[model samples]
Target: MEAHHSEIRILKEIAELLNEGTEINGLLSEVLAKLLHVTGLSSGWIFLVEPDGKHMLAAKENLPHALAYNDCEPMCTGDCWCLDRYNNGRLQKATNIIECKRIESALAMKREDTNGLTHHATIPLRAGNEKFGILNVGAPNKTHFEPEELALLESIAFQIGTALKRIKLIEVEQETALTAERNRLARDLHDSVSQLLFSLRLTARGGAEMTADKETKETFTYIQDLAQEALSEMRALIWQLRPRGLENGITSALLDYGQMLGLKVEPEVSGVISLPGKVEEALWRIGQEALANCKKHSGQEKVLLRLSMEAHQVEMLISDCGNGFYYDDKQGEIPTLGLQSMKKRAEHLKGQFKLKSSPDKGTTIQIIIPV
Candidate 1:
């Protein structure tokens, strides 16, 4: 009865994790971590085929509290035995670590190549016809993984691996769609606004001799300057329209957005919280909105943008020296589209976002989210 109850409880927890709005890594980490608790293993992890197919991404277990993916680095293609099996399409296990000689040998090569990994069991992880990566179990004790334990780990890996593959495919589709939209926007800018700017410049230069009165000449010059300023803004927009590829992970996106977001207020930027591009894009959008508000309504000369990883979540804070306002005071009162968009974005991520400001004080926004 006791054993049966434990199994039931474990399944419930697994189900809950699956239902949560966690990314692939988080879900897998939970599955593996629970299995480790039940089987009494020291450590476990999930791995995935690096998107480029050149190496493997050492994924984390979906535990309640654990290491961030950025804190964990992946092994190279030729270095991981797990990747070799995943690439070669095979699931391997070694009972007593010694009995699994062939796999252990391959793993040892990987270990030497990686400098070393703690003792572990390498199981090929997959979904349908595709191989994701591998599930590995590690313990300080040499004889920690028995045949039964290995079987359980492999079973867990099977289910988790399949789910991971599905999630990753969805992510790819999203990224592709985003890239297409960005490119389409870029084309529109280049064809329409860019062409218009060129024409305006030419027209201004050609008509320079049309007016000889000093005031008339000054008016024409002012119009030309306005056109030039409009052109500059359009050029910046065009740069953003060029979609960054999948290779630009969360850290890269954060860095890129930091520069752009800080341009107006010249905020002090620090620490980078890196995740996938999707997460980064969301963060960047929120940052963009915050900076826009600061410039438009906050009446502040400078703002601060900070990004960092704390516990299992990513944190971003944007504060400016301006009259502070209550977050809910104008909840249904003011109809600012930019602030609405930022709040909506935070809600979408299952995160928390807040804005505190006053009429004569300053504004501070803090956004906390899980990656």
Candidate 2:
């Protein structure tokens, strides 16, 4: 009766380990140790079946196989006895398996060394529709495994197989969620900012052409200047809208990027500007974007930018001599996301912005950010 109760307790413990919420490695190790204790065996191993149904030794104790680990027990099928027994749907023992026909004729041990192991029992590990692997215990004693002991080991192998399946499902779910987030970011960038930049560029090109007209050349020049000024502002807006969190304060950052793009920026600050931190950040980003546009599209050699503070607000002014673009009130003209972002940022802080430019003349952007 005492022996019966002990087996029952060990079986329950194995079941709990298989179903536990802990990590997979921890649970498997506990299962292996408990199985050895329950069977009163000193040597054993767990085998994993590869996709091809070949048996690979995964875990072992008190003896060494090529693949044995406390943390990992990867196994391949077709070569090991444990895998063969799992495919045949039986928990089998081979105390002196060299005498069995299946072990002698079916296994390739006829050419391999036999002293590595003389006695071992193999139990099939099954979960759902598939046989995952095998559990094996061995000893020098030929009669070490009894009929009742083999039955108990099979039950433990079945439970472990189910745990592996659940782990794979969890990994798939996490991968799906990561893919979804990347897709959403791609869509947002294309729809909002990309379309606006394309339309704004067309509008600028039209203005540049009109400045070459004979009758209204001067008027077209003015329009061209305003268009370019607006272009720079729009570019500033897009940088702020960027999700990657580009960092720069309006004055110094503007100078840095301008230098990179083959332009000189002589920036000056005065009157101790004391705007809110985010407002300063937005203005700096706007200035940097404006400088970037000038290098890329303005056709200018040098720009002068100045920042100063008033009683209640801080102001920024950027001036550049560059080919100008005409301003049109066309209804279908697209807005650049960068400029929209700048406008939104300015409006958010209840600040004011002013832009000035022309074809032969220069361009200037003035922003007043409140404290």
Candidate 3:
């Protein structure tokens, strides 16, 4: 009866932590630390796995020196029995893993800093049919876990998994709300500021053409030029807020955008244009930045855009034939805000971004994103 009360206390504490509405990573770390303290475990870690089978080490606490070596590189990468079983649908509940492959590898490497740790308990974090990832807890010199201990871990895992689902749903709703707000703003700008600028340009042009005095005409012409520039900038801002032709596809939208900037976009597309919504959005934004850069700096009116899709990944290459500035790859420098934005968009989706350029050789940007 006393042990059962202790288990209930642990569950209540963990449930409170999960309900604290903290960010996922921080919350997981805190909960892991709390679980270890209350259960007298020495170490723990949490993995957040995506639908694509890629996993991230979301949290860890009290790792031994062997696994903690090199910033916990051992835990950060490669596969192990728990993850394999989780992916293969074999890890449905809390169970004792025969051994931790990562620690085993570290032992074989003769680092000899495991702190007497050999095995761990792996609990699958799941809310019904939805599987989030795995929770691993271990202690120094502990090779197995009791049934009641596993049961308690399983209950904690359930709370964590439900919290993850709730957080993800909230994020999706927030993203949807943001996109709607952006579209509304884009429409308002198009109907108000954009139209006002267009009218201003026309009025300035008429004033210039009707004036007889050279000074007055010159003043009017300057006003007209300023208005025209402002109108162009407003249009670019509107496009950025809510891309106009994105419904058709990224390629079509980019081609239209390039033409708007007075550049000829030569596009080569392989495979169908079907892609996940987020992936397509990222690619479109990156393409917009690349094309805008080409128009602003490349000194050429023509740019090359290539898109290829494979079974597991999508690649985009943007290049120009104009005068490219000197880019030193050794310095790992991103020269412009546009390039940085493109790189960030790619990386946010676990993609790769590459750029190449040299004086008089033009610039090339390549992006590869897994599907």
Candidate 4:
């Protein structure tokens, strides 16, 4: 069985890649490419479950049309019939989707690009009771999968599922370690540095008030002011490290942060501020990032923040009336790293994120996440 030998080789390659800590996207792409090559399939794709559990994210796809068209990804924009069924809990194993509704429907509309694609098979990537996502492989005008081929595909899917689980575990471990380190640093700063700074400020103030000589009094006054500023900065740093009152809610914590930053943050609320812990945490981090960006680049201290909660969703908007960048510029023309990071944070929560900006107009950042 040359085919069996090839399958084993592919699995080994994937295992080696995992050991090297290859990113999930790259790992999926390589695995899909290898599987398509070995099985002589027309195309393949991988869909991973997002954090929200309500949406399936199209992680990687290698298709003939996409490759021919410079990797155009329509799959990322719309959901296909196969995915619809999968989301509805119909997909449980390696199963053939006869006359894939997506491809067939496209063919019916005389879309020439979908030619020869009649069906595909979906294999659920799962680890026992935990299901992660799906691995899909399609053939040209093929409506069924052979038993042996299906078995090999299932085996590959299982391997992928185990790898995904391992990656998830690694991420959780890293995040836990990071949080613990932050707490330790926060405690040290608050108990040692902050207290010392407070004492120094008080002593400097007393010395300045009691001094008789003009020059000596001025020197003590300067020291008192410097120590006071240092204490304030230290408290701000500690707040960031371990966000005090975050457990109570984000509203109060954000207001306090704005006060620390010497910014007039106008808040507008529409509904209940209650939210899940993860949702609150994401919002807190996003708020911090947005405020930091404003302080660094906005050229204005006042900012407007709005939080709205509807029956099924939560929305946040942070706007600043300051110098804005050109949003209509072509690729590589605009600074996008921060914007991309904020968008990623929202997407990680299965939310919609947008930034609006113009040369003279101000910038507005908005995120709407379904609860």
Candidate 5:
């Protein structure tokens, strides 16, 4: 009766956490530890399956040091047996996985960090047919789970699955709204601002050609040039707001953008350029900002963009042979020319970003994101 009451309390606390809008990561960490404690389980971990279905991102893990501290289980890894089974559609319910292969492998290799974890259980975290990932719990002394314990574990897994499904649905709705807004903005820019700019440029040019006085004509010509520049900038903005060529790929879209800006940007590519839609969108925005910065500050028309895709990562480099900032430049301190935005985009993708600048030297921005 006491154990049952403790389990009920744990479930109530977890439900509160979920209802209170705790982020998935924090919720998982807190709930896993609480569940392990309430159920008297040794340890536990959770995995979140990526949208691609090919990768399972390690969400949270709390375990004894022998299994946790080793290279075999360093928080997260792609080479997980449970994840492989989940991906292959073999695991669809709370099932008993006799032993952790990683521990066995480590023991076989005589690794010092090997644990005496001989058995564990895996519960498929799911809401109806929509599967999220797996909830795994270690057994106390490698003991078997009683029928009641298994039922309780399944109940907790169901709670986790429902929470994850709610979060996933919210994310989907948010993305849908965002995409709709982007389309509307793009349409507005194209139909309104872009047209006005084009009309202004044409009027300015016509006035410049008809004016009899040389001074008046020169002023009109200057206005015409300014209008032309504004029109170009507007087009670039519209392109970014609604990318059409991106349907082909990011490289093609970027090349098209460079052409629109009247600048020759040659992007050297290695390996296949394929990425998740969100990731591609981020890169596009970052690339647009980088190019805009170069045009507004670098005073150079031509630049080099390099994109390299590797086994587990993608790298991007934008370099320009133009006037760069000095060593003691205040620009870096001030986050000038959308550099902060670029950095944020990279960070959002869990990537590394760097910018190099020096007086009389070229500027280069490098970004690396793991796939």
Candidate 6:
């Protein structure tokens, strides 16, 4: 009876944590810590698997030195029994994996401390037919888990899985709403501000052509030029919101945008154009920014854009042979807001950004993103 009550208390605390509605990462970390405290487990971690079968270490608590080495590099990558079983649809419940492959490898290498941990209980987190990922909990010298322990873990895993599904649905709905708003704004800009700018430019041109006085004609010409510049800027903004040509592919869309900016875009693409939606969107935005920068800053009218696709990653390079300013690479600082924005877009997708520039040698921007 006492053990059953303890289990109930654990469930109650965990249920409360799940109900707190915190961010997923923070909620998972807090729940893992709470579980460890109540169950006396030495360490625990959670993996959130994407629909494409890629798994990420969502949360961890009290990792042993062996697995925590190199910034937990071991845990972040590589395949093990639990993951293999999970991927194969065999890990349906809480059970003890034969042994922790990561720990075994760490021990064999003798590079970092394992703190005597050799085994763990792996629980598949699922809600109905949907499988989110796995929850792993273990302790020093605890090679196997009892039935009661596994049952408790299974119950908690169910709650976590349901919460994950709810959160993901919410995210999808929010994204859909945001996309709708962007389209609406783009339409409004095209119909209102864009048309007004075009009309203003036409009126200024007519005034310049009709005026008799030289000074009045010059003033009208200046107005016409300013209106034309504003119209170009407005068109760029509208394109960013809608990205009308993106349906075909990122490369094609980028080529069209570069042409719109009056730059000679020399594009070289390798491998298939298929990419994840988020990655494709990010790359498209980054490419647009790079091309816009080339048109505005680079003295040359031509730019080279290269896209390479590999099994695990994609690379994009944009370069121009123009009068370039000296860039101080030693400090690793981005000199312009445009570059900073591009860097942030790449990093937000867990990718890399590199920039190189020198006087008379021109500038090169490279971005690599894992898909």
| TM-scores, one per candidate | 0.49, 0.44, 0.96, 0.77, 0.70, 0.86
Q: For each candidate in the order shown, give its overall lDDT on alpha carbons.
A: 0.61, 0.60, 0.91, 0.77, 0.77, 0.90
lDDT of 6 at 351: 90
- For model 5, name the residue pairs that clash: none
Question: Per-residue alpha-carbon lDDT of model 2 for 1-371, expressed as tens digits?
Answer: 99889778987877776777346555566778777776677666666665445454556666533223333232332254445454555534322232222234323534332224455666666677766666666655454566666666666666777777876567567755754565565566557655565566566566657566665655655665665565555444443344233244445556655664568888788986555546766686677666766776578878888888876678888778887554333433314675556566776666775655556676666777766
Work out candidate 1's RMSD over C-alphas.
14.3
Q: Who wins the TM-score comparison? A: 3
Model 6 C-alpha lDDT per residue in residues 115-213, reported as the tens digit of each score: 878999999999999999999999989988988889999999999999888887887788778878999999999999999999999999999999999
Better of 4 and 6 by TM-score: 6
Off by over 4 Å in 3: none
Task: Tell me the spans in candidate 5 whose CA falls farther than 4 Å from its real position.
Answer: 1-22, 29-144, 213-219, 326-337
lDDT (10s digit) by residue, model 4, range 1-371: 97778878877876676566536777778777767776678677787854344444445445545322444445555667666666777878888654465565556666677646667898888888788777878877788898878888898888888888888788778877887899999999999999998999999989988989999999999998999889988987888789987877787777778767888899898899899656787788788778878887888889999999996789999999999778863453336677777788888977888788886577899988887
Worst 10 residues of 2 by lDDT: 93-102
- Over 1-371, each residue of candidate 5 has an lDDT whose tens digit, in order, gives 98889778878877877666537787788788778776777678787876456444345455655556644254455455677788889987667654676566656767654345666788888888888888888854674766777777788888988998887678878877998898899899889988887888899889988989999999988988888888777777778778879999988888888777767897799999899777888889988888877777788888899999996788889989888786443444525648888888888877887888876587888989878
| lDDT score for residue 27 of model 4 | 77
Off by over 4 Å in 1: 1-168, 214-219, 243-272, 323-326, 329-335
- Positional deviation of 130 in candidate 4, in angstroms? 3.6
Better of 2 and 5 by lDDT: 5
Clashes per candidate (backbone, < 3 Å): 15, 18, 0, 0, 0, 0
Report the C-alpha displacement of residue 366, candidate 1, in angstroms. 1.2
Q: Candidate 6, which ten residues in sequence have the lowest lDDT sum?
A: 107-116
At residue 345, candidate 1 shows an lDDT of 83
